[model samples]
Target: MHIKERLFGKTAGKEVMAITLTNRSGASITAMTYGASLLEWSVPDKAGKFDNITLAFDNLEDYVTHRPFYGATVGRVAGRVAHGSFEIDGDPYQLETNQETNHLHGGNSGLDTKVWDYQTEQDDQEARIIFSYLDAEGSNRYPGNLKIQVTYTFTEDNKWKINYQAETDAPTLFNPTNHVYFNLHGTVSKTILDHQLFVDADRFVELNEQSIPTGRRPDVAGPPFDFRTARLTSQATESTHPQTLQVSGLDHPFVLNHDANRLDVSLYDPQSGRKITMKTSEPVVVIFMHNGASPLKIANNPIPAYAGITLETQDYPDAINQAHFGSIVLRPGETYRSETTYSFHIE
Candidate 1:
């Protein structure tokens, strides 16, 4: 395993770098200090031809200007929080309403847009990069001084793992997830609608008109949301179900009943014979297909609707406000940790 680093660009007068980790199998994953964002993931297809399967911009300017989330690590909180406001211990907190009137992806200036301190390490079988960031108290109108560390490890076995750990000085909420859009055929693949997806879930978080959770976990057994068995994206999109009609495609959180760590979701592209297996410690996984028009220009090409899909592994949305959804509160003296892995191979 090996790692290579080079200047990516300068953000806020601070130099940003891109680090690439290469395994023995000749596949590599490159990420940038900005957002600790995944810039590329090159893997071999059934034909043994290596291709970059993750979507990203060709230049740094696009990332700094647009909020596509792309292949970045999203949080302080991953999903939405109703009305961009919440209460803890009877104290109210207001967040930036970057998406409508709700808080999305940790507000406008979240971890995804931050420049983090990163370091690379490697052993005989794997190469890993660790990114560290500190979210100052009241920085985003949120309480608590939080210190977070996220590590991405690539092993010779073609496994890419993300490990997150955080600590807060006061009671706060935290849910971080890598928002990487994947298209197994290639980053420039026209659409991911041909991909087949399988999620080991019997239920999904119900959403309101604004797409926020309604504190309900509806059964998915007979709906288009039922992805317990592999189903083509095209086939799933054809349903006239309310969920599909509202979102225009798959964009809901699926319940994860597995143990702390095990495979819970998988996606396959029959044309290229490429497949990805994802496992996480989080309780749910949000599947989001780029449904509407995206202003992103990735790889110097215009990104259209349904170009790629994201498997955001993390807690449910608005968990803090919805008691039934569980808690995302991180109390003092507690250390929060979560792991998610993506393993790639050809069928």
Candidate 2:
């Protein structure tokens, strides 16, 4: 059977209250609409016993008071924008930037900070939840009255389907993605260094220290940034390499090998015999591995300092500013549509 939960604090209006997704193996995935955040996800291990695979805080206090942006939905724009500024139609616009100069995760008050309209339903082992929000013309200092709808469905087959759509009364740029950390071998393990990762990408955008694309799409072959073949991820982070130092791990987007329809990206854990496959209609996907920092720094998790890797699917990081890059602009009367799915299967 499917279950639903609703929580509200007299002071806090419309908390996630409850999530209604089933665990195919009798496990559970508890989500909250608070940040449109994922609070709990239960996945199986080698012993056929399911465990909470992602690292997350237990309560709203932990989420609100301390670490957020972990396992939560980030919006407006997902990655970083150089110098917290961009030019659209030759107009220069600057945002309230973070991380010392870059605009990280939309802005100071991104989509995670807004109150979303919650629509949910359940039947038998299947559950569906939809989160919608309206953005004013200058809410984030961006243009247009934008309406976005995100539908999350938990299937009996153990698939987490995410479908996103948006329409604007005026012209604006849009990019949204879920930032979830995964450790198939369980949390508290040291590095995902040994796990095998395969990305069907032949090229990747190089980034400057600010995490903004340098507008150069380099060949992924022979460089440390290469993941064309299934290889150990840590190889890209050796002592003498470029993909190593900038805040650590794989945080860059891979220009996919397949078209912008459905493509499969896989990660396998030899220790647990578990596998994760990521599918999306988007052309760019960012793979980020947690590098272990204090709770005040990054998102809190129950891992050995650095124990998870994040698979974030989206359009390019800073597309609005880069004309050479793909288009993120949603014009009037045009609807933007995209879908990404994260499915789990056993070996």
Per-model TM-score on C-alpha atoms = 0.97, 0.90
| Model 2: per-residue Cα lDDT over 290-315, one tens digit each | 76554442234344534677888899
Number of clashing residue pairs, candidate 2: 7
CA deviation > 4 Å runs, candidate 1: 259-262
- Expressed as tens digits, the lDDT of each residue in 1-347 for candidate 1 is 98899999987998989999998789999999999899999998899988889988767887898767889999889888899898888998898888889998988899999999999899999999999999998866778999999999999999999999999999998988999999998865378998999888889988889999888898988758887879887755788988788999878999987844546999999989999999888889999988876765666767787899999999888888987778899989999999999999889
The clash count of every prediction, one per candidate, is: 0, 7
lDDT of 2: 0.75
